[model samples]
Each structure stands twice: as structure tokens, then as C-alpha cells.
Target chain A: MTIKLHCFGESGNAYKVALALELAGLDWQPVFVDFFNGETRTEDWRARVNPMGEVPVLQDGDMTLTQSGAMLDHIARTTGKLDGDRSEILRWLFWDNHKFSTQIGMTRFLMNFLPEAKRPQPVIDFQLGRLKAAYGVLDAQLKGRDWLVGRDVTIADLSCCGYLYYPEPFGFDRADWPEIDRWLNNIQSLPGWKHPYDLMPRAAAA
Target chain B: MTIKLHCFGESGNAYKVALALELAGLDWQPVFVDFFNGETRTEDWRARVNPMGEVPVLQDGDMTLTQSGAMLDHIARTTGKLDGDRSEILRWLFWDNHKFSTQIGMTRFLMNFLPEAKRPQPVIDFQLGRLKAAYGVLDAQLKGRDWLVGRDVTIADLSCCGYLYYPEPFGFDRADWPEIDRWLNNIQSLPGWKHPYDLMPRAAAA
Candidate 1:
């Protein structure tokens, strides 16, 4: 009874759940979604996999969950490994979805995935500014702590680190933020951490 | 011992928590933040309220919480209402934060809040297009349903309806989406419901 995650390699949101699954040693396998080829845009895919037309849809037994934050919460609850201060963990997860990963996902897509002519410079600049602010909040939060919530590596770590590990140019240079760099290293130092590309199938070279 | 919410009238994220508190009949008051000015940008405010420099920070006794989704969970937990289908509700909350309200908030800010010359037209156009897709997803979900999750009116409703009730032109025309319009009416019919401006104080007339 392996949990199947409907995801693609380019999705940091998907990687959040994938990282958690790998860390927890859950019986799970990645189900590739050909996003760049427009597989998710199909009506049949929408009705069957996810109506939201998004990735990282976790199918566990009869239950299917969308939104990487919610899926991470389910993984934390089921495995009981990354479950720490409830409110603190939830706050960070929500923040990651609403701000951090959301911005990085789009910025990275525009910078690396989209055609060069179609890349909107103004939009990219605006997003980069906002992401710098988001990076500041995350870096400040990690000033003295290894993990986001408590001393343990909760889903908060997995959630916030969704897009940071990607090799693409998403306006994120690890050397720019010392504390976040250290924190990411701490997460990389986990037992069974896998890079996003190694965990899920990528649609393209980017 | 009434709860205090550090918020502004214009923030949809703040309005989510405000709606939950009002619907739950909680003894709470809105402590206005001068976001239209430089209040939230100040280091002192960042340290005292939220390092994220965002609004809708709920202070219940000594416990303070940021991110509207997290605060709504608190209100739901405390009032014993709007607490149905934990995973489903969380999914929608995350969706709203990640997609719906996030885009509307930015689009509305550019369309109305920001100075005319300062508004980024390319960015606004980009966000408006994305907001249309988000609206389509929401409208489709509400086609034959009265609420986002479960039969009961959960925090999902409160969260998704955050920016919809605003008068600002965020590219959302009620007549365009019939299902979403009907669902919005259903929420408006809820007892003790208040519009964003009515629920909290605005900085200036827009």
C-alpha cells in the first residue's frame, strides 16, 4: 500500500511532500505529471487527479490531498516524526505556501522554464523584491535555531525548504543569506534527504 | 480579556480572521495598523508585532499568531465552530492563501491602493490573468455547493471570501461568475457578517 504522489520534478510544492516522505521512510512512490507538456491542463486529468490543476496531490489509500502544506501535515501526523508545536508548525507551513514557495515557484518558472521572449522582466523584478523580503523573514527566523518550529526537524523545515534546493536561477543565491544557508545545510544533513530532481521526474532540463 | 487583532481595513488576509471572529461571536477588537503609512515597515513594529511585517496578527492573551489561516484555525478551535473536515478545510485554506486572496490582494493594491505612477502595469496584468484562473477554479467548485468544505460553513468560506467582499476593483465582476456570486450571497446571509471596511478601520478613502 504505497502512497502515490502525483507530482513533477520542477514543482517545489511537490518536493516538500517528497522530502517529508523520504525523511519519514514512508511507503511512497512518485507519480510523474508531464506539466511542461500540458498534461495537467487536460479536463480528464483535472477530474481524476486534481481539479485545481496543480501538482503534489498525495493519494494515500482512499484519501487524496492537495496543497503541499496540507499533505505535509498528513505525513507528519501519520508518521509522527515531524510533528512539533502545532501552532508554530502550522504558522510556518501557511507562511511557506502563501509567501515563500509561492513566489519562488513562479519566479523560477519565469526565469528558467518560460521562453526567453516571454519572460516579463518587470514581473520578475517585482517578484524578486518580494522574495528578498520573504528570504529576510526566513533568515531572521533561523538566526539561532536549526529548525523553524522547535529543535526537531518538523514539516516546517520541509515546507520552507521546498524551492531553496533547486539549481535553477530563481533569484536565490544561498551564499547571500548566511543563516538560511546554514539552516538549509542542517536540513541537507538529515538522514534520507534527496534533491528535488532525484526525488521526482523533471519535465525539462530546467 | 478580549482578543486584539493587529490589522488594517484593506488587507484581505486580515479580513479572513476578522470574519471568523465575528461569525464565531468572539469578544475581539481590531487594533488598526497604519499600513498605508510606514507602520509595518518599521523595525520596532516588526519586532513587536510580526517580523513578517504583515497584518492580522491575533493576540489572544499572551499568545500571538500571524498568518490569517493560522488565526482562523485558532478561532475555530476556541469557538468549537467551523471545525469540520480537518484535511479538506486545510486544503482550501492553503489554496485561498496561495492563490485566491493572494492574487486579489496584490491586484487590488495595484489597481487602487498604490499611486497611479507607481503601479506596475505588467505585474498587474500578470496577476489579473492568474486571478481569473483562480476565480474559475473557485467558481467551478461552488457550482452546486453552498460551502467550500463539508455542509457546514467552515473557515474555508471565511478564508476564500476575504477579498471578494471588497468594493475595490480587483478584476472580479460578480455577474461574470454565477456560482461564485451565489455562494457569496450565501455567506452574506450569515448572521453577524460584516464587510471588510465595516469590520475594521481603513487608512483613507480610496
Candidate 2:
């Protein structure tokens, strides 16, 4: 059965699941959601697709799953790939959702997607500060390790690296954090790894 | 063996785990972490306690667990309580971390905990807007449901209701959200349920 991922290219959250599917060599297809046009916010879409008004929804046969973390877990568990120390993997996944990727996703959107005049400077600045702290934590965790969790790459790595591959400037620079830079390189070196835009159909103009 | 939860009263993240432990009828003790006094931010604490530099660290004999969502899962699994449809429970837990509690936690800290002069209006306004959207999603999910996941209350309920129980204003009013309000009442009605402040030792003055 083909796993259908409802996603847009601009969404790192969606990209996390897409990357997992690709790396795990699962049979999957991308169904682009027109998120930029407020499709997700509409009552019809929310009622039919996801009431949370978020993307990265995965439909595998009778199961429809939202929340990229949950989707990643599902992929890892079902495929027996990207699986690691369960507790460690889950810890990083929760942290990424709570502190890392969530901040980066919003910050990137505010910095790049929003109109220049409408961009909230103070909010961006605050997010940048928070993101910096989160980056420090990530870099520190990666200081003497190859993967965020166990001895091998896991869903934890995929979850944390969700927004790092983006070209948009969201107050993050690879050169600034050598640990994260090297970690990103490690992820990029994986077989079948593809840039998010190459892997998913993008809704926003490049 | 007794479980030791490193937490403080002000942290809603910690409250999630605390509430789960209490409701599960586990023999647990709260080892207060002085969050406001910069304990979690210390180098020693980060290295020794949690590299993520966050709270709700649970220790049971040889195992040390961080991340409230993961801890909730651990509690539910080990105690045979608050466990339900694994996928549905995880979906809501991820959503709560990514959208609901994280925003409310930060917004509440800025609005009430921070010095009035140091509060950034734009950041607070932005977070309030995001929090409102999250509240709408949660309220809509609870429209005709007694719990967030499954037929009975699970960690999903504990996770989402973490920040909602806090007295600090984070632009969330239970009165404005009737469904969430009623759902909260259902949680409060659960035996052994305690307010966050009551369940944990608070570092801040009430």
C-alpha cells in the first residue's frame, strides 16, 4: 500500500516525515496541500483533512496520521529502520517539537514568507534568541556524538534536522555552529537523501 | 521503588508528568528545580541533569527520563493507567507540545513572570495570537468529547491541560472556550487530580 503524505514544500514538519519515508525506502507519494492560499484554514479542509489546520498528514490505507513526530515514529516502527533506543529517540522527538523545529519553522516563515512590511521584527528577534538557545542545546548534544539518540541515525535525527536544510535565512547559519554543520553533513550523506524541495512538491515560488 | 520527578511548580511541562504520576497513583516525589534562579541554565545542570536544559526529569532507580511527553508515556506504560490508543495519544501529545503548551508557557512567562518593563509587547502579542489558534483547535476537538484521546482520560489530556490549569494569564480564558472548559472540568473531576501548584513545590511566590 502506498503511503500518501499531504504536505507542502515549505513545511519542514512535512519534510521530516517525507524524508523518513524516502530514507526508509517506503512506498510513498506526496499530495501537495495549497497551504499558502489558506487552504488549511478553511472549515471544509479542517473538517475533512485535519481539524488542527496543519499539514504533514499521512494516509496509509485506513489510517490517517497527523503530527510529524507521530508519523516519524510510525514509519520507524513499521519499517524497522531509523529505530534506536526508544526512550532517547522519543526524548529528542518531543524536544524538537517543543523547542527546536517549531521555533525554526515559525521563524523561517516570519522571516521569509511573510511580507516585509508585515513581518514582526520584535517577534522575529525573540524567536531568534530562543532559537539560538535551542541551537546551543542541539550543538551541545551533538558535541561528541554522531546521532542524537543511539549509535545510529534514528527518527530523532530526522525530527531535529527538519528545518536545517532550508535555504531561507531564519537566523541560523551552518558556519556558526560547527557541530550542527557536521551533523547536517552526516544526514546529507545518507543514501537516498534528497533535499526537501527535490523530495516534495513545493507550493511557494522559489 | 519511588520515582523522583525533578520539577518546579511554575513549569507546566513538569506539571504534565506530575499530574500523570499523581493520577496514576504512583509513589512519586517532587525534587524541585529552581528554574527562576537559573538552575536549569547552569552548565553543570545541563551536563549532569539534561542537555535539553528543561524540566520534568523523572528518575526511577537506574533510569532517568526527560521530556514530559515521554515521561507521560513511561508512566502510562509502567503503571497500566492512562494508556490508550497509542497512535491517537501520541498525535495529541505531539500537537500539545508543538502548538498548545509551549506557546502558552512562553506567553505566560513573559506576561506574568517577567518584569513588566522587560516584557516585549510584540512577542507577547504574536504568541497570544498563536495560542488563540491552538486553543481553537483544542476546543474544537473537545466539542463533544469527554477526553482528548480514547474513551477515557489519557496522557493526551494531561499534556494539553498542563498549562490550562495554571492561574497565570497567557491569553487563554476557560470561559471563552466552552468546550475546553467543560473538558477541563472532566479532568478536575478525576480522582487524585490536583492543581499544578498543589502537586509540585513552587519556586515562585504566589
Candidate 3:
């Protein structure tokens, strides 16, 4: 059976999986979960796929998978893109998912989605601090490098771009991160990057 | 030259890389970074390796990798541990690093390490909500399953174990997560998992 990914419309997390499938040149069905109507929270939806009641769950025959990072890794490995120095590539991929994506993504989500009245300044400040701190580190790492791992693009670049390019939504200024900006531009120029973005125009708008 | 990883001595992030090196059975050098002294802030260090100024930067020959998720992916790819159904494995690994490891690890860290007076309840609440949400999803997925991916252990289990087992520090009651607890117990029994915890006496104490 072909792989089927269940996710919400225009969700960035879901887009990550879609992007990976495109990059790996795999054909899969996209099952939309209506987040606005709370479709993901239904018992039936939760039982068959995600218990967490979250979007972006990939069902491959009998095997099911969750988490965007894992999905990206799975796609890369399955498609033979997880090549080159194995250890080196895996390390960068982990970093992207764990550090850059986690911290920055959290900041972006909060600053963009949370209502001003509900959002606390300290929380915003704390996330921004972490984001800047992470940027500083990323800037240094990208000094002479074009990609997070190896000469060619790997899931590391794809994973990082899942959140890095949407800084404007989080109110982060990209001008401060030249290296990241250059890297983002490089990934955007890739052939695979455009496929999913074109299919989901609203996702890229964010 | 042997692979050199620069990181703080007592960091879980750093430990992720160290654990990968140990599991991969590769020879490497560990460079201790002084977090209290603010050594990560040095321009030289930032310029040469990570601009994020975080620990656990792995340098092999001329290639340096930052971000623990990326690092793990690199190691797995390089060491040939990324086995089984490639996409399946990669998906779980990414999920472990991005969702499970990232959320659980951060929640645990803040609750355990940060001073009570300085800890933010909302952040804790947010993380806790996310954690429980993730756990519910994982518990459902793990029902009648041995590991997150295939029948055997993969980087996905390793990555999740790095954070999931230490729920106490984060004020998380394992009783609430029977599946995760069961899985954690299983992983702890493994020789690979035990090796690092045994070597790091301090971690055992915590």
C-alpha cells in the first residue's frame, strides 16, 4: 500500500512531512484533518492514527509514524538520501530538530499565534533570548558552510528550513542572520522545495 | 585526527553526541566547555565551530556539525545504524529528536535546574501540556509495539531514551505514562543504554 499522511491544512509541521516526501520523490496521499473544527480531537480520529490528537501522522500500511523530525529522517533513509558521512549527517539532523527547530519554532509559534493579552512579556522575552542565542550559534556554524552537513543538501537543511525561513511570522528580523538567510535562500532555490510550497500556498505565506 | 566534540561536561545535549560516539563504537575526543565561565560566548569559539554558542559541536577532520538532532542523524548515517525500513526508521528518529526529546528534555531541564523563584509557571504549563499531549500520542502508538520504529532498537529509541527516562527531575510522574515507563525500563536494560549511564556517575546520581 502507498504511504498516507494525515495532517491539517496549512500546518507547518505537516508541511515538513509533505516536503520530505516530495524531496524523496515519493507519491503519497494527503488526508486533511480539520484543525479549525477540532477534527483531530475526535475519538475515532485519535484511535486509528494519533493518540496525541495532533496532525502530521504518516500511515504506511501497517506502520504508523508521528513527529515531523522522525518523518524527515524516515523519508531520507528510505529514499537513499541519508548517505554521505552517516555520522556527520545524523548529528546535524538531530541538532536541527532538537535545537534550532525546537527553540526557534516555539518562539515563532508563540509570538505569532498567542493573543497579545494572553501572551506574557517574560515568556516572549525568554523565547526571543533563546532564539537570538541560537541564531548567534547558527551564524557562527554557517560562517563558511553552505549546508548543515556535507557539501550536498541533506535533511539537516530541510529540517532547519521547516522553521527558520518563517521568521517573519514570529517577528524575528532575518537581517541579523546573514548565514542563515543565505542558507535559507539556497534551500528555497532547490527543485524539491518548491513542490510542496506550490501545493500549499498558505503555508509559505506564513 | 579523531573526532572532537566540544561541549559542557554535564549537558544532556552534549551527552547525546557522546552517546552516539560510544554507540557507533568510534574513537573521539571530548573538549569540555566551561558554561559558568561563559566560554561559549568567545568570538573565537563561535567563529570556528558553532554560532549558536552551544556545546556539543562535533568536528571531524574539516567538517564540524552542530545541533544534536543533526549530529545523531549524521552519526547514524555514517555508522550504518539507520537500518530497517529506511523511511520508517528516519521518521521515528526525527520524532524522537524533534518532539519527544525536545519537549520532554526542556520541560525536565527547567523544572529541575532552574531556581523555583525564577521558574515560569506558564512555560512549565505549556511544556507540560505539550508533553502530556505527546505522551498520549506515543503511548497509543507504542501499544503492543517493542520500539518506536522496527522490532529492533534504533536511533529513535536512543534519542527518546536520552530524555524520557528522567521524568522525575522535571516533576513528571511516570505513573501517568505506563507505556513510556515500560519502554524506558526496557531501554535501560540494554547494554548500550547502561554503558553511558554507568560511565557518567553524576548522571546516575541525578
Candidate 4:
């Protein structure tokens, strides 16, 4: 049976799972969630789809999974290719969720998705400052290593690169960190790689 | 050799690991990090300890691990308790890291740690709003359940409960969310439970 991913193009969290699915060569398809229209917030959607009210839910027959980090773990375990030091992979994934991707997702939403007049300037500035600190750690970690763990590309790589490919300004400039720049290039060079927009059903389908 | 956890009282991240260690019956000790004095970010501290410049690093002989979520997993696996549905456990762990604990940590820092005049009101307000939504999800999930995943208590509970115990003002009141409040009580009533300040050496102690 083909796996179904409930996702949206604008969601980097969704993109992380999508990237892992594509790279693993899984039989999967995207079912876009109209996040911008508040579909996920609806009571019916929450009860039936995911009570957590988050996207990128993977439907594998009777089994359903949410959280991109957990989804990546499922994919890696099933395929046995992306697995690395379990603790290390989880460390980076948790860090990305805690510090990196979460900050960028909200920062980008404020900077690009919110109406110009409604944008909270103070919140954006605060998030941008935090993002810089997170980026510094990631870039420095990548300086002497080819992968996040003692490995060739793991889910940590797929997880951290989730929000960086979007054109929207989230205070992230690849050119600003040479190590991250090279790492991005390395991920881009992988076979069967696709940008988030190219791989998922976009919110507006533009 | 005893497991060494580099932590401080103010860090709820470290508290998650500390709780896991105590419950798992692991012999461990907390080595304080002077976060309030900017020790984690100094060049020497970063070089010698965690390059990520963060606390809650677990040093067990030749193996060292960072990230509280991962540290919990290590403790759980090593001691053979607190394990549950892998994907479900991870989902809540990620949600706690991405939305619950991280938001509270920052909001509390802004509200309590920063000088009164330096606090950014708008940022605090925005984060408070986001935190309310996260708390709603958690409270609803715990409406009839005693734990975050499965029938037994797991690291997910430990992870999500990390920041809720702090006395600092981050706009959270246990009375406001009955389910979450009850769930917190459950965790607190666990055997060998200790407050974060009691479990770890405080920053001011230095």
C-alpha cells in the first residue's frame, strides 16, 4: 500500500518528512493540508485527522504517525539506510525541532505570511537573533564533518535542511555560513532530491 | 564510573534528564554550568565541553551525549524503563521540544532573567499567545489519560513537564488547565521525584 503524507508546501516540517520519503524511494503521495486557510484548526479536522492539529501526518495503512522527527525515524528504520548513531541522530533532530526549524518556521511566517501591517517587528527581531545563535552552532558543527553523525547523510541532515530551501526571508542566508552553504550543496547533489515546493502539493498550488 | 550530567538548576532541559536518571536508578551526578555568568558561550567552555554551547550534556565514560530528549532515551534504554511506543514517545518529545518547553524557557528567561527595562514586551506577548495554544493541545491530550504515551509514564512526560515546574512567570498557571495540572501532579508523585533545583547544582552556587 502507498503511504499518504498529509502536508503543505509552505510547511518546512512537512518538507522534512517529504524529503526523507523521496530519498528513501518509498511509495508515497502528498495530500495537501490547507493550513493557511485554518483547516488544521477546525474541530472536525482536529478530531478526525490529528488531535494535535499539526501537519505532515503519515498514513501507513491503519497506522498513522505525526511529528516529522518520528516520521523520519520510521522511514529510516523501515529502509535501514538513513540510520546512524541513534542518540546523535536524535540529538540533532531534537535540536532542530527545538532551536533551528521551529524558529525559522515562525520567523518566515511572520516575515512573509503575515500581512505587512500585522507583522510583529519585535517578535521577528527576537526570533532572528535566536536563529543566528542556532545557525552558529550548526555551522560550527559542520565545519569539520561531512555529516551530522559519524556517518554519511542521516535524518539529521534532512531535518535541519528543511526550512533553508524556501525563498522566503527568515533571517537565513546560506552565503552567510560557508559550512552550512557547502552542506546544503551536498544535500542538493543527492540523487532523487527535490525541493519542498517541487515535492508536495502546495497550499495555493501556484 | 558514574555518569556525569553537566547542568544547572535553572535549566528545565537538564531537569528532564535528571528526572529520567533518578527514576531509572542510574548513579549520576550533576556538574553545574554557570549559565548566568555566560560560561556556556565562552571559547574555552565551548571547546572543552559542548561545542553547541548548551547545558544538559551527559558524559558517560568515552561516550558523551547532549540534548535532553536524547539523553532521556539513553537513560531509558540503559536502565530498561520508561520505554514506550517509539513513534508516539518521539512525537510528544518533539512537540515538547519544539513548542512547549522551548517557548516557556524563552518566555521565562525574558520575563525573569532579563533586566526589567530590557524585557521586550511585544515578544513576550507573542510567545505567550503561542504557548497558550501549545498548552491547550497538551491539556486536551491529557483529558482522560495519566501519561503522554501508553499506559506507563515515559520520557515524553518528563520532556513536556520540564518547564512547567519553574516558579518564574511565563504566563502558565496550573489552575488554568485542569488536565495538565492533574498530569503534572501524577509526575510529581512518582517515586524518587525531585525538584530541578534540588537535583542539579545551581548557577549562583559558583
Candidate 5:
């Protein structure tokens, strides 16, 4: 049975797992969640699909999973590819969720998705400052290394790179971060690597 | 060997691990990180401690672990307490990191820790809205349950409850969320449970 991923393109959290599945060579299909239309916030969607009301919920046979970090770990653990030192990988995954992707995801949504007049400028500015600090941390860690964790690419790399591939301006400029830029290139050069927009069906209008 | 936790009381992320160590009956000592004094951002601190420049780093024997979610898993795995369904536990742990505590941690810092004049009003209002949604999700999940996962309290409980126990307000009022309040009570009822401030040395001035 092919694994089903309930996701939308705008969510970098969802893209993390999709990229992992594709790169790991797993049989997976995308079921788009109309996040722009407030589908995730609906009562039926919350009750039936996810109580957390978030995307990137994966169903593989009897097991239904949410949380992109956990899904990435599951894909890596089951496939035996893109797997590495568990503790180290988990550390980065947690950091990405706590400090990296989550911040970027919200900042991107505020900057690009929300109506220009409705956008909170002060909030966006604050987030951009925070994001700059987070980017510096990632760049510093990537200095003298190709991947976030170990010599080979792992889910840690996949998790952190989720929001970086998008074209939307979330106050991140790859040219400004050379180490991160090179590290992203390393991920892009992977055999089956695909941009997030290419890997998942986007909810945003082209 | 005694575990050394590099943490400060103000960080809910650190409290998650400190609570776990205390509840797990581990011999642990708190090594305070002077976050307010800008210790974590220093080059020497980043080079010697965590490159992520965050707290709640656990050092036991030769192993040094950062990220509270990873450290919680480590404590649960090694001590055999607060362990539950791996996927279920991880799902909440990831959710807490990505949504629950991280948002509250930042919002609380902005609202309470930062100088009142320096606090950005728009950012606080925006974060408060997002936090209400997160609180609803957590409250709905805990509606009829004693804990976030399984029949007993686990790291998921510790992780989500990290910021909830704080005295400082970040727009969260226990009375406003009955389900979450009850769930917090259940965690409080746990034997050997200690408040975050009680478990770690506080860096902020009272």
C-alpha cells in the first residue's frame, strides 16, 4: 500500500516529510489539504484528520502519524536510508522545530500569505530579527561541513532545509549565508532531490 | 554519575528536561547559564557549550546532549520512567517543540522578561492569537484524558506543561482553559513533581 501524506505546498513542515519520502525512495502520494481555505481549522477536519489541526499527517497501513520531525524519523528508520546517529539527528530535528523551521514558516506566512494591508509589520520585523539569529546559528554550524549532522545527508538536513527552498521572502537570503547556501546546494545535488514546490501540490496561487 | 544540566529557570525548554530528571529519580545538578547576561551568545560559550546557543544541555558521563526533546527521550530511554508509545510520545514532543512551548517561551519573554518599553505591541498581539490556537489544540486533546498520551504521564506532558507552570503571564490564564488546567493538575499530582523554578536556578531577577 502506498503511504498517503495529507499536506499542502505552503507548509514547509509538510515539505520536510515529502522530501524525505522521495529521497528515501519510498512509495508515497500527496493528498492536498486546502489550508488557504481554512480546511485545517474546520471541525470535521480537526476531529477526523488531526486534532492538532496541522498538515503533513502520514498514514502507512494501520499507522497514522503527524509531526514532520517524527514522520522524517519514521521514513529514515523504516527505509534504513538517510539514517544516522539517532541522538545527533534528533538534536537537530528538535532544534529545527523549536528554533529554525517553525519560526521561518510563521514568518513566511506573515510576510507572503497574509494580505499586505493585514500584515503585522512589527511582528514581521521582530520575527525577521529572530530569524537572522537562527540563520547565523545554522550558518555557523554549517561552516566547514556539507551537512547539518554528519558526513552524509540525514533527516536533520531535510528538516532544517524545509523552508529554505521556497521563493517567498521570509527575510532569508541564501546569498547572505554562504555556508548555508553551499549546504543547501549539497542537498539539491542529491540524486532524487526536488524543490518543495515540485515535491508537493501547492495551495498558493501561482 | 550525576547529570549536569546547563539551564536557567526562566526557560521553559530547560524546565522540560529538569522536570524529567527530577521525576525520573536521576542524580542531576543544575549548572546555571546566565542567559540574561548574554552568556549563551558569546563565542567562547558557543564554542565550548552548545553551538545552537540554547540551554538545557545535559551532560552525563562522556555524552553531552542539547535540545530538551532529545534530552527528555534520553532520560526516558535510559531511566525507564515516563516512557510510553514511542510514536505517540514523539508526536507530542515534536508538536510541543514546534508549536506549544516555543511560542509560549518567546511570547512570555517578550511580555515579561524584556523591558516594558522595548516590547513590541504588535508582535505580542499576534503571538497571543497564535498561542490561543495552540492552547485550544492542547486543551481539546486533553479534554477527557489524564495526560497527552497513553494512560500515564510522560515526557509529552512535561514538554507541553513547561511554560504553563510559569507565574509570568503571556496571555495565558488557567481559568480560560479548563481542560488544560485539569491536565496540569494531574501532572502536578504526580509524586516528586516540582515546579520549573523550584527545579532549576533562576537567572532572571525577581
Candidate 6:
């Protein structure tokens, strides 16, 4: 069955789902929603699917799924791309969802999305500290290990790399995290690495 | 193999793992980490497992897994507790992790864990708004359905209920969410609801 992903054109969360589909070599149709016009909040759009009024909702045949992490897990499980010891793969996947995605990704968003006048200096400082701490954890985990889990790339890497690379667009330095920098470069060099980001040009900012 | 979960007693994240195991009818042992004494930050604990140094790490024999959402998904999949159309189950699970778990759970933590002097009112208000908005989405989703997904209980419900009930200890109001309240009561009455929580009384505040 062909999978169709509905999401805003310039979203890292949506890119997460798209990147996984590309890595898994799965065919998917991208249904772009215009975030500038508040398309996600529309009742017709939300009520038809994803009552949460969020994007990156994937529809496969008759089934629809949300949450980039969960969707990635389902795709990985179904396509037999979930490599490594089952428990280990799960461990990395959870780390991506909880720590990396929540702390780092959200902090990146706050740093990027908020207007200069509206963005509080303390909030930015706090999130920067969190991002650094989180990166330290990821850096430590990646020490001497080629991948986040197992030897080969997995959904965990996809989920994390999508957000980890966002700092560049926001003009943040990646110098402190040499391992993470290498990992990001590795992910960028992968086949179809640019497909999702290409669809969202605004994601790679000045 | 006996499943062992290492976590502090009052953590909602830990409760998520325990709830999934119980719902799946899997026997597991709970190991407490005394956060009060900084047990989680020890190098021995970090080196042995969980480089993230967070709890609700599940150990199945020789395999160790951390991250509560991923752990819950693993248990659900292993025990066959996740039912309904695979796509729908996947959607709800993702919502549980990304939306409910991230937004609502984080708000509760800030309100409870951060001292009043350090807790910014604006941040709290913003998070509270986000939580209420997300809860509205869930309440609407639950309007006609007894469970979050499918006919029976699934990990989606367990994940959502775990976070919703967590605020009871912090004196968060539940009366505004009647369906949520009813659902929380239903899950609390389930067998083994108290076992993991009992093992870590401080983690299960209410």
C-alpha cells in the first residue's frame, strides 16, 4: 500500500517521517499543508484525521498514524528495518523520542520560531543549556559507536539526526559536539538524505 | 526471563513502563534508584546502562532498554497488548508520546519540581495553555470511545493515563476533565496498578 504523509512543508517533525520513509526505501506521497495559513487548525483538516491538529500524519491505505516517533517505529517494524537486538533498538528509539526529540528539538524550535522582541533572553539561555546538556549525553553515547544503536543506521538515528542538524539553520555552533557533527555529516551523505529537507527549503535557513 | 525496571518511585515515566507491563499481564521486577541521593547520576549507573542517566529503564534478562515510551511500545508489541487496526494503534501511540506525554507531562513536572522562585509564571502559563489545548484534543477524541484506540485498552491509554494521573501529587485540577478523570479511575482500579508504584512510593505521589 502507498503511504501518504500529511504535514507542513517546512517542519523538522515532518522531515523525520519523510527521512525514515526514504531510508526504508518506501514509496510515499507528500501532502503539504500550508502552516502560514493555519491549515493544521482547520476543523475539516483536523477532524477528518489527527484530532490533535498536528502535522506529519501518515496514512497507509486505510490506516492513519501521527507522532513522528511512533510513525517511524511502525515503519521500521513493518519494513524489517528495525535492526539490532530488539531491546537495544527500542532503547535508542525511546532515547530519540524522550530526550533528544523533546529537549533538543523543542529548544531549537523556541530559539528559531520566537520573534526577537518576544523571545526572552532567559528562555533562550535555559534552552541553550538544555541543548548542550542533551548533546553531551548524545555525544557520550556515540563515543566509539558508529551508530546510535546496533552497527547500522536505524530509525533512532533518523529521528535524532533530523533534529540535531537543525542548529545550523539557527546559526548555533556545532563545534563543541565533534561526534555529533560527524554523525550529522554521515546522515547528510546518505542516499535520499536531501529529499525531505529539499521539500522544506525553509528548514535550512541562513 | 523476568523483566526488571529501574526507576524512581514517583516518576510518571516509570509508571508508563509499569502500566504497559501490567496491561500486558507481564511479570516484572521494579528496582528503585534513590534520586534524593543522586543515585541516578553515578558513573557506575551510567556506565552499566542508560547513558542518558534517566529512569524507567527496562532490563529484560541481559538486554537493557531505557526511555519510557519506547519501553512501553516494546512491551506492548512483545505481549500483543496493542490491538485495533495497526495504523490506528500506531497513531494513538505516537499521540501519547509526542503530544500528550511531551506537552502535558512536562507542564506538570515544571509546576511540581521547579521551585516557585525559579519557575517562571509566563512559561508555566504557556505550558498550561498547551496542556489544556492538548487535553481538549484528547477529550474530544475520547468523547464516543471508551478507549483511546480500539475496543480494549492499549498502550496509548496507558501512556496518556500515566501522565494525566501524575499531576494528582502536585494538586493539578482534574475536575475540568471529566472523561479524563473517569478514565484515570478505571485504569487505577486495574490489577497490579499499585505494585510498581508501591515499590516506589515517593514516585507515585498520590
i-RMS, each model, one decimal: 0.9, 0.9, 3.4, 0.7, 0.9, 2.5
Error of 2 at B151 (Å): 0.6
Candidate 6: stretches off by over 4 Å: A82-84, A167-172, A201-206, B23-25, B81-86, B167-171, B195-199, B203-206
- Docking quality tier of model 1: high
Report each candidate's C-alpha RMSD, comma-separated, in the order given: 1.1, 1.2, 4.5, 1.4, 1.4, 3.0
Error of 1 at A150 (Å): 0.9
lDDT of 1 by residue, A110-169 (tens): 999999999999999999999998999899889988889988899999999999998989
- Per-prediction TM-score, please? 0.98, 0.97, 0.76, 0.97, 0.97, 0.88
Native contacts retained, all candidates in order: 0.76, 0.75, 0.82, 0.96, 0.76, 0.51
Report the lDDT tens digits of candidate 2 across residue range A105-190.
99999999999999999899889999998988899889999889878899999999999999999999999999999999999999
Worst 10 residues of 2 chain B by lDDT: B47-56
Model 3, range A1-206, lDDT digits (tens) per residue? 67888864356677667777777778887876766567777998887777667677888777777777667666776778734566565666666666667676667656666566776566667677767766776677687998877788877677666765442466456687898888878877878676343544342224
Count clashing residue pairs per candidate. 0, 0, 48, 0, 0, 3
lDDT of 5 by residue, A1-206 (tens): 99999999888999899999998888999999999999999999988888777798999999999999989888888889999988889999999999999999888988899999989888888889999999998999899999988799999999999999999899989999999999999999999999888888889897
- Candidate 6 C-alpha lDDT tens digits along B31-61: 7777656777899988876667787788987
**Top of the candidates by DockQ:** 4
**Candidate number 4, chain A TM-score:** 0.96
At residue A85, candidate 3 shows an lDDT of: 60
Give per-residue CA lDDT, model 3, range B37-98, as digits (tens). Answer: 66778998787777667666888887877667667666776788734566666666666666
Give the per-residue lDDT digits (tens) of candidate 1, residues B1-206.
99999988988899889989999988999998999888999999998998778887999999999988988988888789988988999999999888878778888988998889999999999998999999999999998899999898999999999999888798999999999999999999999989889999997675
Candidate 4 DockQ category?
A: high
> Model 3 chain B — which ten-residue stretch has the worst lDDT?
B196-205
lDDT of 4 by residue, A88-133 (tens): 9999999999899989989998998888999999899988998998
Docking class of 6: medium
**Between which residue pairs do clashes occur in model 6?**
B9-B203, B10-B203, B10-B204
Give each model's whole-structure lDDT: 0.90, 0.91, 0.68, 0.90, 0.91, 0.69
